[model samples]
Target: MRRRFGQSLRVGVAPGALALLKTSRWGGAAPELVGELAFEGGSHPEAIGVALRQLLQGGGCANWPVSIVLADELVRIWQVAPPAGSARLADLEAAAALRFQTLFGEPTGAWKLSAGWDPAQPFLAAALPRNLLALIEQVCAAQRAPIVELVPQFVAGFNQWRAALKAGAWYGLVQQRVLTLGMIDGGAIRAVRATALPEGADLDWLAAHVAREALRLNLAAPARVAVSGHAPAAWSKGATHAPLACHLLGQGQGAGWSDCARLAATGSRP
Candidate 1:
């Protein structure tokens, strides 16, 4: 049985920063930003754990159930064909683990995997390093913060944008040195890809990548692209023909990174 909690804390863990928000009703109202913390160097467990400790101490979130949205670099996501029959959970997990090892050349036994399936399309699975999970669990435990969920940043972003996504349209997201492009048709994801951006790469490069990936996936030009972290104009000119239509993720006052946090807080799954 799941435990019920009154207030929830949502944390977005990126390469070198953390975005925190608090909400009382999951999916009911927009989450309020508690604070954001930045750390030097890459996303090391020790560094992130220390920052989390400090944030919890200062932000009055020690008692809330926490849901984490991990940066693309920290989590691995793969879209695979759905299981054929009524396969058991264990069987699906084993298959996903095998695929993970084949694609990334890493031993899946050492990683923690979570798979989400949709009957109409391929299943999406996310993997995280067990050591990283252990580090986060230890830190949260020390702070008396219970972690209820952990999800990929793309999954959280998609959930926040799902309502805005149109049937047969393409969607692209660029954030934290990563770019994710996807196609949604009839309210279901058809094809998706996530790639890392090179150091100091500009929006033009990102636009080209998105366009190329969409073409590779045999998707039509997006009706409108949604953007975050940078201005939409950055991608508009380089995205094939005329300036592409773009929608800034946080278009108004109540949107932004916190929208991702709000989705996570609400337990929205991919």
Candidate 2:
């Protein structure tokens, strides 16, 4: 199971000197807070705090965290696993919150924000109640972002759920092990194609796969096609695939998140 929570800020402070603020995810308006500091610096922590206060006073933006709801099953798994480096879930949660505070050069109590988690998995059809769906549908309909694609992990019997999308809505295509399609009305995916490249395949072979897939989909030369996963790096910089935008692994956050907000919201901290 996975848990999700939004971030409000991540502040880093230098020893008794400078403070820097970095934005987390979940783009939105963020509230201000006085977070507690957990530090070991001699005179640095105090100096850092002063620096942070000045920085904020000078008109700086506070970082916001992304909200990600976790699945229940995943929670149980973490509970049983031995804590990493002798630290239990609680310890990690506290540390994470403190890290944000210290990074911003704030004194103890400079960057703690509330974490919100939904009990039911919002992404799942059966778990999403009518009220929530209606509320979300209305919100999504109003979005001007043009597209917001949600590429859920491929699970058995997933296609059965796609029928719920509204008409004139985007189409969903299942191509082998991957699901590729457009997310908005004006934006088109051009094509959704997949080809399996053996473990040891070279860039040339991969480019061939891309070429073949592009042709099969009859996709117009996409303004840009981003390729991600473990294999993209294998392609040469100026190789034939250069015409397309390729990246390893889809874009977003990293794989490992020691985020306690997500954990606390789901009641799964580990």
Candidate 3:
């Protein structure tokens, strides 16, 4: 049977900001953006909701599957060993809950959980707050839109450049207040650390933190570094111990959160 092309809505949610885009593909062609909602922002949830509702109403997105791309700071991610033996999803959830509780303490019952494992790689589990997700769902449903997926921005960004994450390489990504640094070995993530950057942080501070993390992780000097989301210019000037080559996302020196949102909506990574 020939498949029918359906439009999908992608929503990128970050601190005080939200962006929306509609993507669709016809026949065997690549997916393309068909519509976009103006970027919306507010300091509070009620205000943000109002903006989202207004945008949704005006965007004419009806009966479409929505995919949410959350900021890295909002999504908790962990890498763990796969459950022993043939375990069901429920078993994995149980294990994930334990790990979450250990790290965060107390289950709020307001979080959604998901876990996945690839062959010869450690399991990756992620969680999103259910209350916020429900709010988005309610808003979209009111406009005849149903949400189909929710992904963390980092995971989506990684998916965009998975081919380049070679073994023994280090990567750093900055988005909003979050700065993520990690190592990849044989295309599998070896170690990762995500830190919150203070407002008005400078390149020196960022470079220093990167160096400290490399030391803490016992990672050797990186041969190359990948940066995204408002990365400082100094990042390309060999800011680390090694004279490292740098790769910037998109055409410019940094990446936009919307790119990650679009990738999350159309690509399969998380």
Per-candidate clashes come to: 0, 37, 0
Give lDDT tens digits, candidate 1, residues 1-270.
122466677787766677777766554555667788877756787887788778777776666788887877788878766567735776677667777888899878778888775543567788887877888888889878899878776777676666776555556666645567666655556666766777655555555665676677776655556654433444544545453555556433234554334333333321
TM-score of each predicted structure versus truth: 0.74, 0.28, 0.71
Which scores better on lDDT, 1 or 3? Answer: 1
Report the error of model 3 at residue 84, Å: 5.4
| RMSD values, in order shown | 5.4, 19.1, 5.4
Candidate scoring better on lDDT of 2 and 3: 3
For 150-259, candidate 2 gives per-residue lDDT tens digits of 11222111232233334333332222223233322233222222344465555455445555554664543332323322223454354345544332322222123222
Candidate with more favorable, higher lDDT: 1 or 2 = 1
1-270 in candidate 3: lDDT tens per residue?
112366566777665566666555444433434333443343344555666677667766677677777866666877655467635666666777887788878783878887664433566677887767777778888988787877877776666666766555666666645677766555666666788877665555655665676677665656666765555555555445344556655434213435434433324221
- Residue 98 in candidate 2, Cα distance off native in Å: 51
* Model 1 weakest 10-residue run by lDDT: 261-270
Question: Which regions of candidate 2 fall more than 4 Å away from where they truly are?
Answer: 1-23, 26-187, 220-224, 239-270
Q: Whose TM-score is greatest here?
A: 1
